[model samples]
Target: MKKVKKGRQEVFEEGKLEVKLEMIPQLLAFGLSIEQIAQGLGLDEQVVRQAAQPKS
Candidate 1:
């Protein structure tokens, strides 16, 4: 995974990261699989899987 720069706001400014993060809850609420969300977002399945997991 690429390291995200601290204090950077590029993703927030552009909105792709927010959109992708929001899709996690939306997909979960709709009972969609991680693979499905990943496919829909053109992200890797593992990325979606990790996002779906509870944060420590």
Candidate 2:
């Protein structure tokens, strides 16, 4: 019998937040609204908004 391969799993790690931060610009450029990106990334819209805040 042939074994079927499962799809890739989404592993959430500590540094994932940083990765998300980096992708924000590209995501925004792609016309993805904050709410959309948040939902797609399994994150809260508020969290995504906070992360998108500019640093002082």
Candidate 3:
């Protein structure tokens, strides 16, 4: 597996879920994996993974 550098750290509780959701794509575009984005935003990897999924 490749090493990942920690990116920007963020906190978006309750009211900021939308903001956090919006950031998922931007972070992905920056080449960050779900784990990295979760670490950066202090969230669970699963939460990031779910949020990263396309809306149905």
* RMSD of candidates 1 onward, in order: 6.4, 6.6, 12.5
- Best of the candidates, lDDT: 3
Instruction: Report the lDDT tens digits of candidate 1 across residue range 1-56.
Output: 24575325565655886679767977888998887888888888887888888878
Score candidate 2 by lDDT.
0.75
Model 3, residue 12: displacement in angstroms?
Answer: 8.5
In angstroms, how far off is 2's CA in candidate 1? 23
Off by over 4 Å in 1: 1-14
Clash count, one per candidate: 0, 0, 0
On residues 1-56, what C-alpha lDDT tens digit does candidate 3 reach at each position? 12222222233245477787789989999999988898888888898888888899
Q: Clashing pairs in model 3?
A: none
Better of 1 and 3 by TM-score: 3
* lDDT-better candidate, 2 vs 3: 3
- Give per-residue lDDT, candidate 1, residue 7: 27
Cα error of candidate 1 at position 50, Å: 0.7
lDDT for each residue of candidate 2 in 1-56, tens digit (9 for 90 to 100): 12222222223455676798778767888999999989988888888787777778
